[model samples]
Target: MPTDTRARMVTGAARMISRRGVDAMSLRELAEQEGVPLGSTYHHFPGGKAELVDAAVNHVGDRVAESIAGTRGQGTEHIVRWVLHAWRRILIKSDFRAGCPVLAAAVAKDERHRDTARAVFGRWTDGLIDVLIEDGVPPVRAPSVARTIIASLEGAVGLARAFGQIGPLDDVEAELIRLVAAAAGEPAPGAGR
Candidate 1:
């Protein structure tokens, strides 16, 4: 847990949004949940829910991008498996209650939320493309392949949540590993155990 009130609020907002989405995530409830005064939330985020939501989305995006970047030189399969497993653990740990905050924001009615989601998704896609290219995927093919992996994984997370099972994530992980392997002109590795 973050000791700083603002950081804790943003992290709590991201967690809340992951499960219930932006529209349903109340700043008041989040402030209460974080044991902070509602006034403090306004003090930290004067722009209110929109500002907090933006920070939450960016927080999650930056974390994911940093993790992906950290896996550089580990090969596409490792990166793919690492990402899949990370999401899988989140699903299992939360008991299927949570999905991607970025996805939740992407489908928000607010144009600002959608725009933020787009930028976050774009950052993730660009990072994945770079990793793929480094791992031997041609630049032209990297973009589409990176997008496919992201889209598939995001959809799988939704399915896993909807079905209250991790099967969708597992299935997508296997196929994505195969796809990345083929794109990199290497033999496909089995899904990580």
Candidate 2:
């Protein structure tokens, strides 16, 4: 719904990549999907498909990091639930057709795409680690706990998409809350609710 053609193209490319991945997403299809002329894609992304893919990856990555950062004082359980609910909504809204754009890029054959994913994942993990530390999780354990949460959620998203259900995400969310609670030395909120 972005009025700017370039922004629309980037958002559309992210959605396309979520479903079809990097190698399978063609610029021409992206143009048609975004209702932009093929030449405009070149104008906006002079580096061609690689440039567009990078932009799309960064777009999704920034959005996700910002979302996580927004939950600074909401407590660990709320943060975990919020993140899982966001993914669950995406799965249901897209009819299980879409997964994470960054994950899609990470699995691509292109080294550049993988590198972008690595940086994005690092940023997300760092943000979560900071939030965990804020919630009283030991600094020593926050990093590993953050990484585990992200890795498990990413895998759960893929499983949810593949199985056409959100059960995988739900299961991961429950376990993640317990993992985080244990790390924070606090009782798990709504434990086994």
Candidate 3:
């Protein structure tokens, strides 16, 4: 089905972006990866690589947003743990070859890709902030905490990918879980009043 083909193209692009960064993506390679003809790439994405890249970035962003949704009514530690492991799995599954697609887009040289990255970043930050607030993080602190988590995670993922190991992310995860618990005024692990 054309629908499946289009979705495959987007997925292939996302994976490519995750692994190699946006600078290395090619529409033709994406078509090949999806088993679709080169022309179909254009047929599905009228704006060509730019459109495909936009879709790819959005696809990854939406997946993260969906994961955040599952943390509704959970504590900040729960939310923090879920997000860190979710991203960790990506590194483990990809053998540390892939990083975040949104990061790739954010650092892309093109203006269109940069704009798309901005929207995805906002969506991710806003989604996390909402859950942090729900988990009793003070509204005044939620945004700053959410931003720090996102920023740290992004950096950690990059470093982990660079070294072909997950230590950086794991270290950051530990710190984030602690920070989240502190932000929500929860007792630290194994601590007593």
Candidate 4:
């Protein structure tokens, strides 16, 4: 099954824009990277740069939601592990120099882009919240807990990247495991120290 050229171009552009800020992108540059002709780019997105950016933002959001949906219905531990592995893959794919795609777009001024970013992040939080609620957290608290975990993980990634070491991520991972365990009233491994 062959994918339509526009969809392929959008997918490639979304990956590139996620790894490199939108401000640094151009249609010509995207065409070159995608190996698609300039005429085809305009044929697919006649509105040009703004339209391309919009498509890219939505494309990335859908990609993220699809990834999270695949990991649904296991357990909180599984979700946590999936998140860690996903973050590691993103970090490596971007050469450890880029912030998260949704996070970057959140700080960007374009309202539509930010909305797309928020939608993507909301899906991730909601997915994790479902796992947390299943693990016995109060339904009302699950979303907040999920958000805290996400914020902490992002912060840990930033710190680790800034220091050029993975210690921050490792510490955050261990602490996340411990926090989730304690929330479930499971005995922490090395308690009573």
Candidate 5:
């Protein structure tokens, strides 16, 4: 049952982190919310809060990355819409109380947690790169376009959540779709230079 409790605690931590952000999710609160014994947290995460927080970051990132992969053959517009609406739904469902854990973790004081967030972001970027390449984006331009899309998504979502509106996401959708199309239609960046 300890293993189950540990998993519950980790899953709960992700939810808590989403709603409260990394800086605000205390271990005691997580324990109580998850209905796990306080000691179970230590047993499951010997490295303590940083470990749990980073784990939550990975947990969230993994789920989103899986969603990205599941979008194979969905086209750039569908993929972009899927990504945007996912965040939109997360915000709208939670009444703007919840946000992205990866965004929260990216600002963590613990270097390890931030590093985990970076790795997760990198993995997401890689997944998008594959999708864009498969969508006919030139291989050389896919990486840059993918990174740009990620940056835009992250920033736009952050702004959208801050304002409790989806305008930022809507605004970026057209821009990113155009950007991806241009990447596919144009020569690789610096091809002449």
Candidate 6:
């Protein structure tokens, strides 16, 4: 099998496993979703389901890191806008069907899967903290702020999915922007928060 085909299979399987828990996923299902031959799947991931799943998790995590890196623009407002845009894009593009990918993996029954999720999540949070510190937030507070920002976004995603509406995300984004600005000692907009 081609490397691109195997990569597509990894992403498709991850998305499917996220929508339906890991227990509901199988190698054949992933191959079908990727429109690849079942035999090709084994050729790529000889270890089978576990190997494919781990690869998917890592692939998604790398994407998350790239997204974060892309969001580091001119200033704090730029970063906030970028973050908000990312969520809006995710919600609109996905039809609000799934929550955070890391959160989805975190809920997996298998300990190995959960650990994979945690490591990815930790990398994302640490990346955010690094960006915050770069943007003038005090180093000591960066990690806490990053964790809070992640929590707020994750919580908002959950509420949006649960209520079938996007209002909660909007509200959370508003407060998050204010908090990020305040932490950086930037001039908050008059209507902020």
TM-score (all chains, Cα) for each model: 0.92, 0.92, 0.90, 0.81, 0.90, 0.85
lDDT of 3 by residue, 12-49 (tens): 99999988789889877877887899999889899988
The number of the candidate with the highest lDDT is 2
Lowest-sum lDDT 10-residue window in model 3: 184-193
Candidate 1: regions farther than 4 A off: 1-3, 186-193
- Of the candidates numbered 5 and 6, which has the greater lDDT value? 5
Clash count list over all predictions: 0, 0, 0, 0, 0, 0
lDDT against the true structure, each candidate: 0.89, 0.90, 0.84, 0.73, 0.85, 0.77
* Model 3 residue 118 CA deviation in Å: 1.1
Each prediction's RMSD over C-alphas, in Å, is: 5.5, 5.1, 4.5, 5.0, 2.3, 5.0
Clashes of 5: 0
Residue 52 in model 3: lDDT: 90
- Kindly list the per-residue Cα lDDT of model 1 for residues 46-107, writing each as its tens digit: 89999999999999999999888888888777877887888888988999999899999999
Model 6 lDDT-worst window of ten: 184-193
Stretches of candidate 4 above 4 Å error? 1-4, 186-193
lDDT of 4 by residue, 19-121 (tens): 6667666688788878888888888888886677777777766766676667666667776676677767766666776556666667666787778778877
Residue-level lDDT of model 6, residues 1-193, one tens digit each, is: 4488888988887787656666667888777778899998789889887777778888888887777777665644565566667777777777877556567678878787889888988988888887887777878778888889878878987888778778887898789878887888853234366
Any residue pairs clashing in model 5, and if so which?
Answer: none
List candidate 5 segments past 4 Å from native: 1-3, 189-193
Q: Order the candidates by lDDT, highest first — what do you get?
A: 2, 1, 5, 3, 6, 4
TM-score, cand. 5 vs. native:
0.90
